[model samples]
Target: MLEDFERGRVSAFFRRVADSIPVSDRPASLVITHLLAERPKFLEGVARLSDVAAVLPKPRSIDEGALRQVKAAMQVDELNRDRFADPEQATAYVESRAAGRSLGLLDVGGYFAPALEHLHTHFSGRILGVVEDTENGHQRYEELDKLHVPVFSVARSPLKDPEDYLVGQSVVFSTEALVRSRDDILNGRPACVIGYGKIGRSVAAMLHAKHVGVTVYDTDHVRRVQAMSQGFRTAATLSEALAGAGFVVCATGNFALREDDFARVANGAYIASVTSSDDELELSALNSMYARTPTEPHVVRYSRTGHYFYILADGNAVNFIHGASVGPFILLVQAEILAALALLASGQYGPGMWEVPAEVRQSIAATWLTYFHGVS
Candidate 1:
């Protein structure tokens, strides 16, 4: 019943955002993304309303159909996948790419803040704007709030309401995966969720709904209080959270978990990452501690302590792992991306980091409700 309601709400919300995009033809855009097959279709559709000069591919091991389509449309600045691992190279590449182009930047990870800063420093006038689609990226962009370039983000969209519904659906997908992995049903097992952000809160809610005992830990007192208000256990320290938890979900985007965390975890506790970044689980530190690499898909058994903990998607985004069925949620965000680019091209918005305008947001919600979901 909850899922049904969320689906209707998200679809309606997405349609309204789509409606807010000006009907006038949009200008050329440069899209930098972690290429996914579905993403290209949406990008291509949006381009018909606007011109796109290039689609820069960030290397993730996805099948190449969508990537080929993107290449067919325009030049693909093929950066080596290794560049993403090094901040210096990645930032440098972005600066080089953005040099002297007044094109709109449709950015995925939002790691291009340095490049944006560089463009500002060099006085190349201004690009159309920047659009970011990830929480980590949005947070990074907020740090540069003083920049003159017009910045917009779907990752920070009010429609998805990251703190509640959107994160709620994502956690539902992940919990389903976590439960299916075990032969025994997960009911009543203690689960520790780090970070009381949107993702963490949703994860805890779902786990608790499934009759799993949940403990939440966050550095912020307010978040901890929020967790407590929901009637879940609250941990004062990391050690306390991991002490007896049979399942641990690291939703914090920051590097919070480590060898010390593993040592503190219950011997057989499963540690999974809900955040997209590899550093969320600190796999490199874990690998250094282990003599051999994890051979199985998304499963890592430590060599030193012979401690076994399964990593969903090899510590990548557990929700987006193969067959998670969260594509609908991703599409909702994609719709906002298209609208964001259209807004940027319309020249209606000005320089400065800002939220997606409320009118645009409402338009998206109205479109989805009326046309897509038949909510009229």
Candidate 2:
């Protein structure tokens, strides 16, 4: 059977947010793109609240069984990334599916924003604003020259802080799981974290707690200084960070590592990512340059110049390979997204990026504490 939704903390959190909004203010239709994973049980609850037009499964991290369950239960049009080889094709498909519908979007990694942007011009129906869920997506929206609809971002919101920290924990957990499978241990190893953002900070901290030596490198000088202040060794450049570390984790939701950087990785070191492969590493270039051999389940060895390195999960987020399960704490971010959707449907915000209101974040935190910690 699929995960028990009735007993899910995330499902209950979604219900609580939904109940707080007036039915008249709920969006009439929605297009959602998200990771089809068991831990994130909020999708079904969101579907029940609106006319879900189309559902797109995230490419790398989708859980097939969970996708099947969602498809069977919701009966919404399901779009697969494989069918639309090019991203533009997926955008076109969503446009066709969105015809004549006043639609709101709940997106992960900003996959559908371009489609929504296109729909804004000639769409017959209203374009309710979007609620975006990741820093990567938030940056994608920011890069757009102009926004025709308001965007509510929960990525940098305080409500997401707990989830981000837990995500870091999961990244480390999965990395260790993969390492231990090879009969190796992480303790006393020198590690490099390629970003000093929210998730990267937590990953470095957790690794340090386990007696690992952590070196951090970020393009931002301020973040580098922050890492130094936190008592972790800070690298002056990417090459410096990769040169000696026994393990590497890419936490920046950007192309943090490239083909040239791979040459700097220590031989026999394991590298993993915390976000989508495309956003974290240049896999296509690496594959072309190195000879790849399957080393283990979710592990691959790439060799050149008589030195080699291992990539966990074929460069995808290691946590997903180990079941990207972050537990009930993720519900806080989900609640914020649902609440933002309701606000967007009300048409209170205009065309631009809007932070989730402080009061709304506070209210969500209060409710979370009440429900999970027995604190009002």
Compute each candidate's TM-score over C-alphas.
0.81, 0.92
Model 2 C-alpha lDDT versus the unseen true structure: 0.80
Report the number of the highest-lDDT candidate. Answer: 2
RMSD of 2: 2.6
User: lDDT of all predictions, in order shown?
Assistant: 0.66, 0.80
TM-score, candidate 2, is 0.92
Task: For candidate 1, write residues 1-376 as lDDT tens digits.
Answer: 1256654555445444545555464466667776765555566555655566667765543437767766777678764536644556654554465544456778766656655755545534356778887677777678874766788877757665533455555655665555566553466568898988876787888887778898999988999999999998999999998888887888777766875776676765666776554548767766666554554455555555556555556666665554333444455567777777777777788777767667766665656556545776
Best by TM-score: 2
lDDT of 1: 0.66
What's the residue-level lDDT of 185 in candidate 2? 90
RMSD of 1: 4.9
Off by over 4 Å in 2: 1-10, 23-40, 75-91
